[model samples]
Target: MDDIDQQLLLLLTRDGRASAADLARELSVSRGTVQNRIDKLKREGVIEKFTVELGRGEREHQISAFALIRGNADDDRRILASLRRIKEITQVSTISGTFDLVVELRCSSLARLDEVLDSVRSLPDVADTQSHIRLRTWRS
Candidate 1:
């Protein structure tokens, strides 16, 4: 992507609901240009999908944590499939380290988080998991 496209993505990241006209105004481009670029970004898979980012007050009731997972390389497909089925597993990333994956979990309550963790631990291929509960957030 070019500089303009990168800037457009930044603006959208801050507010996904911004109108085409507003985005054009900020980007100093025509509305049609903004819309066309957005379409191109989506078509090229640079933009996966758009969804709401909950406000801090709404997120305050939720519990979030990160899990560093170590598993058998051959069993990754099975382990990852199991993780993807759990709605609480928001994000997962493959990492080059002692851990094979880093998982992000968000649940409504501590009890629910405990249950989700238990379920994750019981997955057949998951050999080891280190969890860190987030106490507070200073940034998004």
Candidate 2:
């Protein structure tokens, strides 16, 4: 919430596995101070959770796409719940525009992606969908 906390978060974002001692050394503070700050950040919900970033080798073979969905209002909950069960669908968000929901998908092959898209299309109340395959990712 303060300058020190901001700096600590920035460092953690770069390397979530950094030790308290390492952080303390970089921040010119005691190890306990770093630990306490990290604990406080978690308690206050500023640090939601730690996660891993896959290496290029692990991701290069994967195909990714975004599917924009338009569905009936009454079936929104059902449609969303169904989409959540698909392993390839990583993220979904409700949007205010032409599309009612935007779903992010990742699969090992184009055939798998098509299968997932077909599954989505068959879901009840899903009136229409437009998919855009990601050619390349320049940045996160």
Model 1 global lDDT (CA atoms, 0 to 1): 0.93
lDDT of 2 by residue, 1-140 (tens): 88889999999998999999999999999999999999999999999999987777878889989999999775599998899899999899999898899999989999999999999999978999999999876653
What's model 2's TM-score? 0.86
Error of 1 at 67 (Å): 0.9
Question: Pick by TM-score: which candidate is best?
Answer: 1
Candidate 1 pairs with clashing backbones: none
Each candidate's clash count: 0, 0
Q: Provide the lDDT at 130 for model 2.
A: 96
lDDT of 2 at 117: 96
Please give each candidate's TM-score.
Answer: 0.93, 0.86
lDDT of 2: 0.92
What Cα-based lDDT does every candidate model obtain? 0.93, 0.92
Candidate 1 Cα misplacement greater than 4 A, ranges:
none
Worst 10 residues of 2 by lDDT: 131-140
